[model samples]
Target chain A: MKKRLFTPGPTPVPEEVMLRMAAPIIHHRNPEFMEILARVHENLRYLFQTTQPVVALSCSGTGGMEAAVSSLFGEGDKVITVNAGKFGERWTELVQLYTGSSTEETLPWGSAITPERLKQLLKEHPDAKGICLTHSETSTGTASDIKTLSAVIREHSEALVLVDGITAIGAHEFHFDDWGIDICITGSQKGLMMPPGLALVAISERAQERINEPARKPSNYYLSLKKALESHAGDDTPFTPAVSLVIGLDEALTMIRSEGIEHVWKRHESLAAACRAGCIALGMKIFSSSPSFAVTPVWLPEGADWTEFNDALKHDNGITVAAGQDAFKGKIFRISHLGYYDELDMLTVIGAIERAMKAIGLPLTPGTGVTAVQKAFLGK
Target chain B: MKKRLFTPGPTPVPEEVMLRMAAPIIHHRNPEFMEILARVHENLRYLFQTTQPVVALSCSGTGGMEAAVSSLFGEGDKVITVNAGKFGERWTELVQLYTGSSTEETLPWGSAITPERLKQLLKEHPDAKGICLTHSETSTGTASDIKTLSAVIREHSEALVLVDGITAIGAHEFHFDDWGIDICITGSQKGLMMPPGLALVAISERAQERINEPARKPSNYYLSLKKALESHAGDDTPFTPAVSLVIGLDEALTMIRSEGIEHVWKRHESLAAACRAGCIALGMKIFSSSPSFAVTPVWLPEGADWTEFNDALKHDNGITVAAGQDAFKGKIFRISHLGYYDELDMLTVIGAIERAMKAIGLPLTPGTGVTAVQKAFLGK
Candidate 1:
């Protein structure tokens, strides 16, 4: 049975993108690959909505996070990460491992961090060198106001605003330049709608200048941004790239560009809205008060075994969704509407949930979820 | 033009393997992906010649190197690394980054670290937790004697032997169990005949025990071997894997197994013999006195401009071989015979080199290189 992906990432890949990935392998140093490499850079710049050069790496989004910490700040330098969810907490971990230990402003689980809090914290800290935040917290399905948060960081003058935009870039509206973001990182598997193994780092000129400054700690050999940039300027990576995945991403980015940026965001917005409405009509509550357009976390109704519900949906209906992480595990589930998704797919997910709930003796009409989703789609 | 790749890595991927990689995307956590992941683990065991579970990561071979350092040794722990070539030097860098420091027994460039030297070092530094060496140093084309080096470490009974087999495993003979190699790390792009995404680590139970001992330093979020093994038991990865590349490696391993492990090593041995004979017949000197069977690094004859030779080969004959790295730059070039290459490919590479050299006024007899390679292949 062919299953549909409604998980936050490693999302459904377009056939065109898949074929592009399956294309013949080429030498990364060859002129042919150089052309593809240059194209990937250009496409990433367009997706980031910035003129800053985007560096492509053959590691996961975590590697991009590591790069941000290892390159921008030296050992023992003070930094702050907005810990709103699992990813935000990971920012603190990466900072501890790569740069110096970090200070974290953590929100309660299933909550979003506010720009006002960040403004107050940074002003108090005064000497912090960088501020890190997750633009879309996939773990909790909460989206932060990165644009406003970055503005606050810019006002602080000493700190650079770095964003982990792994699940936000294509599905949400992020103008890297307009937001005054210094370092924006994303992965190919998430909103980019490609396979895993490529991490993109879009570094502003200001960030680049900071990275070039001498730091106390020794830089990582593979994650050295300066070396990567020097090699990238000649249309080559500092290391062997995931060549096929780069091809996949180039093709996927072209599709996103063709769909138009605003339209892409609107597509995610409508899908998320419909899915959330369907869940509410099924007598469920949304997990986060303020949710992201990428995914909607929903609380399972009382006495509903989320593990059993997830298994039934996967085994019976061939529908794969995301279960909750950390303490929320087995209490909440997530429905993703980002990356190669449509209204029809959203409806299919709703239909599966409806079937699973009715089979488990939960109260539901035959097409109650479907009717609510349709109404939401039509703005009725 | 179709280009032939003889680089140390990002080697020529076989068409069948490419097709496997091009397979329709599957959910990594689904049954389909579980089956594929299981096959990857099983076949990797066969390739590593060990029964211990192997872990695959969606990172470069360098990541595997880092995993070896960060997992077994904590920060401030003493370790030993052999610096014979670029890859060995990389091990030094990783140790410094993850473990905070290590002692390196420097071997002169283009020279192998003799077993006696390793024994001497271990005896001098009994406090060392592990010993690191590259089985095949791609930069210098030097092959270390893993059997003798492991014997030296096993004599100590305390220090584990870590071998960086990134370019050696399938092409060269390695017995992880028989040779007592505690940690053998490799990449899919080398002798595996696949794209660059997956890094394979085969660790002995003894190495796992070392990791189990609590250290003061915390484990890395991405390179956490403990977390990875917990997920591996269920045939799943903790993070999003490079799914298509895993499929390609599975298929490539199947081919290798079907061919028989001994026969694969025999093929590489014969191909390497032919390559060396061809180079010598063309009056080029071998770079490493004890050459690695995976790649042959050869010094250009006097006054031969390496840049012109490589460019003509790539542009005129559509042959892309590897240039030397670091201090060896322009002084030598490498010809890899690791994956997806046979006598015919070797003949083509040697023939192209002869033509390129002749066109650039380097001395070479007509049909000299070809006849030598043919004779070696024919065992005449």
Candidate 2:
């Protein structure tokens, strides 16, 4: 089978990067790996759009969020987490678990948290120590306007802003320093065009200062930012790192740099627009009102069997789109154009979804979705 | 230069496994990856020689140790850590950092913890909540008799036995269930013949019960074994695991099962003996009295410059051996036979060392070390 990936994360790795990682393993302590680490450090900062150090952790994107909560927030510290999707809910869970307290600013899964509502939440909880939210929520295919939201927080409280940029950094337009984000986390599989297992965390100076606060002792050791920072200063990791992933990350970052960050964002924007147009042409409603460029979710028809449609897409067309998670499971299918994606890739997926929908007896005109995708992709 | 690896942790990975990993990555949530995970789970138990579940975490070995401490031990719990070398020192650090109370049973770096001494320590710390130690300390090339030490702890104290088996499990003889060990952690790069990202932790029934105790709240979310075990029942992980690494591990474990665990141990034993004999012929003192079969450390000649010798070995012979860590740095060199090593490989490394020693102006017979390695490998 041809096996095409349209999952949010683990989208697709470049073949060159995969081959580079498969070369014989190198010693972490050796000079060669240290040189690689140095390049990875500099290049990762470029990817995050930050001047402050970005530490690469050997875990999933969720671990990066865990590190932020455990390292910066002390016991009983009040924080605000926006719950619009699964990842946003994770922030609430992690902050509540670590700090024993959190104030939630929640919305429907497909709804975005506006700066106005965030301002009201900050007004209610004026003493919040931190503000946590996901820039792009994978499960809901929604993206919060972090720049405006961070500006609102800056006007209201001194709360440090933490953003989960897992599906946002490479695909979405981000200005970490300009937007005043204290901490931002991204996963390798999403924006970095590598396999899972490595997470890059960008910490601003204010967040580092909060982490070093005497009152906020590090409750967790494995994901401690203080230790990572100290080691990262020397281009080394606190523990043995995921070396092959980091090496792959270097190549990935280099590819991103060569493509130009603005062009990367433009490509994602075009692909996302095409996907939404194609789904609309298929008579399927887009799931999110505030959709992210990383993924596009479409509602299943009223009587369509999700399993049968999924089988047609996966088995027949070799296309694997992500099934909805949490409350939306088996209700919607998500198509990702997150990494290493182009206009033709988006058109191919739309064609597959169209075929699958027709196979499941869902009302759809032949060539409608593909034609819409072509028109959108070509800006006609 | 054609390169060879002899690092204690990151020993060479098989070409077949590397090629498998290099193939386009499959989605971790897919049925294909699930089948691979199932096979990995079964083979991992066989490698650990335990009936209990072995959970894989997406981090280095230190993260695995952190998981054990945070999951199984409560705050202010009294624990005892034995410090014989670098890894043992890490145990002291981790336990102290987590529990804030640890009694030390210190030994010289190269000395093993005898059964009598361990018994005395257990008797003194009878109220200890946990007993933490390392099976093989890589820094000083020391290996403790874990079976005897566990027996002593079982007899004298009710404390849980936690073992860091990073460089010990596949190379040395281990009886996890029979030894009454509560927790044992190892990394993929060590005796597992894989890369460095994944860590496998074997947890016994008692340890799982300890984790379930009302007072033992998990302080960590990322490395939480409780979450891991719950997910493991369904043949899944709580987080996006290192998918490529798991697939590679599946193949690596299959190779181990084919070789038979006893033969694997015997191969390591043979390589260790050969390495020790070759070093002896070079008039170098073995660094440890109770050295591990995983790696052998040898003292450098009085006038030999460590950097020059290393350069000769690496640049001239394409053999990369580990430099001594901690207090022994610049004084000794370490040669690892932990994973994927044969007697011929041992002889090749010995020849490299002899040539390097000669390059550094140290007096040595050219073929003496190789001859000794051949004799010891043949058990003559």
lDDT of 1 at B71: 81
Alpha carbon lDDT of each predicted model: 0.85, 0.90
Per-residue alpha-carbon lDDT of model 1 for B1-380, expressed as tens digits? 87678887888888888777666567777788899899889989999999987899888898788777878877778889999888888899888887888798888888988777777888899898888889999989988888888987898758888999999998889999999988999988899999898889988999878777765354465766776677777878877788778888889999999999899999998999899999999988999988989999999767888899987888889888889888888999999999888889889999999889888888778899999999997867
Candidate 2: segments with Cα more than 4 A from true spot: none
Model 1: number of backbone collisions: 0
Q: Assess candidate 2 and give its TM-score to the true structure.
A: 0.99
As for candidate 2, its clashing pairs are none
Q: Provide TM-scores for the models.
A: 0.93, 0.99
True contacts kept of each: 0.54, 0.75
Candidate 1 stretches greater than 4 Å from native: A74-76, A98-102, A233-235, A301-304, A358-362, A378-380, B74-76, B98-102, B301-304, B354-367
DockQ category of candidate 1: medium
lDDT for each residue of candidate 2 in B53-165, tens digit (9 for 90 to 100): 99999999999999999898776889888888888888888887788767888888889888888887777777898989889889888888899889889888899999999
Backbone clashes in model 1, listed as residue pairs: none
lDDT of residue B174 for candidate 1: 93
